[model samples]
Target: MGVGVLDQTGATFAEYLPGMRAVIIADENTWAAAGAGVQESLRAAGIDSDEPVVFPGQPVLFADDAMVLRVRDILAATGAAAVSVGSGSINDVVKNASDMVGRPYLSVCTAASVDGYTAEGAAITVRGVKSTVTCRAPIAVVAPIDVMAAAPSRLTATGLGDLFEKIPAGADWLVSDALGIEAVDWDVWDLVQGPLQDAIADPDGLRRGDLEAVEALSEGLQMSGLAIQVHGTSRPASGAGHHFSHQWEMEGYGRDWAIPLSHGFKVGLGTLAMCALYEIVIGIDLSSIDVESRLVAWPTPAQDRARVEALQPAPIIRESAVRASAEKYLPPDAARERLERIRRVWPELRFRLAQQLMPASEVEDILRRVGAIHHPSQIGVSLEQLRTKYFQAQTIRARYTILDTLEEAGVLTDVVDRLFAPGGYWYGRSPEPRWTDAS
Candidate 1:
């Protein structure tokens, strides 16, 4: 029914075996990265070595439907209670596969890179469209601080970006509420938002591998999953930014020809853009607000065939987004008049955000920080190619995201170019490695 976190604990898998004979599912990379330690710990905890089953290849590369069926077959044949040995992609495969077969599983997180470790839904690319499949939340989230700290830096950065998304996503939820498109629960807002704010304020704690910070961020991720469970939809945790990521996943096209960013990273950029767009449309400053950036140096679309085949989004999606922007993100007319807010502040906010989230800049920084692919050239995408056909990326998802909103309002293309141009506004904030500045 919920999640349990085991910190500095070895052989945590031993606890799940009584429920069903455990089958530890891990991919090649994960097995190499953290499998031996987990195996040793499990053996020490009294679970037999024969219980673990390592899936072939990397989890991300195994998102194909055939792989899911293979995993399901393994589980059914072994009658093993599902347990995953990685984060994000691996967890998603096991979670979704287990749910499809009505089984419970536990996740031993090797990285703190995504909020999905405890989420009840799996983000899967099916038939080239990135969509969430109903799934079971991990019964336990087991990760030692040392193990998580040792994870790939970009993976940790991805987690930071995922946590940062709450600010804009929560705001969008409010916007949707105002437009009568969906109901917003203040309870859900307070539940996840509180921890998210704490994590952002003290991100340095994470940088130092502080147990409290790591635990808090992990909790926040689970809280987001719980929020979705409360709402019976992703509305409480995902919004326009997620839609943009889904669109890119489906279309496989990104401007500036950058490598495909993670879902969290893509949403992070979309959050900044959505926030800026909200200010532009609603006429507010919001400049005092500081949001962390999730840079994408070159984001070329990744799904070519799907992008060409999908239809443009429904018109109401855009209309609802605009109405939501005007009603929620922007102050109501009377409130704006009395509050003495400056509309001019919006342009400055837009430019600053655009600069900070520039694909090229993000690519360089991420590459330096995580040693991951950062350039469009590296990913085989070019600006000319994207500019000529990037519109296809906008059609992959049915969700009404910020891009869709901008397209509806007729400002998306211009804004995208202006934001990515040379000497364009780059508002990236300096990374502080300690919480001293936060307090």
Candidate 2:
């Protein structure tokens, strides 16, 4: 299906009938940014809302009881047949809330920061923990390329992160299918794969603020939404990476942390870390490890947090990475062979990944460009914070991705060392990869 566009022309909301009765919900930031245009558009479309609900700040927390109560009151008063949300958070709120009321709603996306815009479930914080609750996908998703291109660079970066997540996530899904731990949806995969590739290949299109890139991103996100709808769960779009993010949210550290990264940003980092872990693992052999030696003594979150805080620049992250590797059940040669086999099957794997995968190097560059924090130092997030998130991430999600695989096999510590090694693939504070040397 072709995309649905509703430019800021102030006529988009007219697509719905005036008599149809609807409530418009938007957060303060979004409301101020585009409120006039949206209201004008609705008015032009012959749709008039007696009440428009606008909340302060962004709707980052889905389980805010006050917001829920307010929305419920709005719905009750409007007796509206539907809702039209003007932001991602607003969309999730309206969508999930509408689901509760058996009402349908449409959304006009304001930022590309999240994939939830088109997904069938809302990621909400319930009782101070991030939780994914199933909701109906919007009946329509509207976006104008002009509006999207003008969004902050970080929002675009977040969108890129969301798109990048599909790789590790898809791999985990495939592995689950192989192990019979979860069911895979080939159709869902089929739908998203093309748009995903298209988006990755043309990331320059995004950096250049190309309208086509915006369109592709929008399309890819929507495809992800449909995939969730098809699977009746987020398994198709989220995996270990998401778990890591969720775990961080649940641990309460991320909540109280000095600087909080977006869900996509945290998940993106996890994806990169997990992919690196997987590569290290698949490069080895599996049967050689002594089972007893491979078990994680399973440190407490507090201990893990302390270890993370104690991380000294590059050595610390690498130590944890290497530690993770040492415990992996798979031997280095076998793990390497698996990667080689995947390469044999899809010769373009690395090339394709090079586009979407935001390594620490890429993240560093972007962070510098946008003046955003890229280092643990920049955010004042000590190694303890990282440890807390990492450990918690393993606990929240059920997927057997790289972290789980390593923890299960007992090579987690070794992998941590390699991952955080100075000059390693993760970026910054590095002794450098031993094989490559300065000229």
Please write out the lDDT profile of model 1 over residues 1-439, one tens digit for every residue: 1122332123445554453566678878677767776666665665544567776662244454566777888888877677688878888888888877888877888777777876778877665445578877876667655667666555665676676667656655554443344657889877777777555444556656566666666677777877877776777777665654555555544322322356665565445445444444443233332222201111123332223333344343333333333332222343333122222233453553343232334334432343232233333434444343324334444433444434433355665555346533322322323211111
Per-prediction TM-score: 0.66, 0.74
Per-candidate total of colliding backbone pairs: 19, 68
Tell me the tens digit of each residue's lDDT in model 2 across 325-385: 3343244455445433433433343333344343445544543333223344433455445
In order, what lDDT does every prediction score?
A: 0.55, 0.58
RMSD of 1: 10.4
Off by over 4 Å in 1: 1-17, 40-49, 56-61, 202-213, 253-260, 284-439
Candidate 2, residue 418: Cα displacement in angstroms equals 2.7
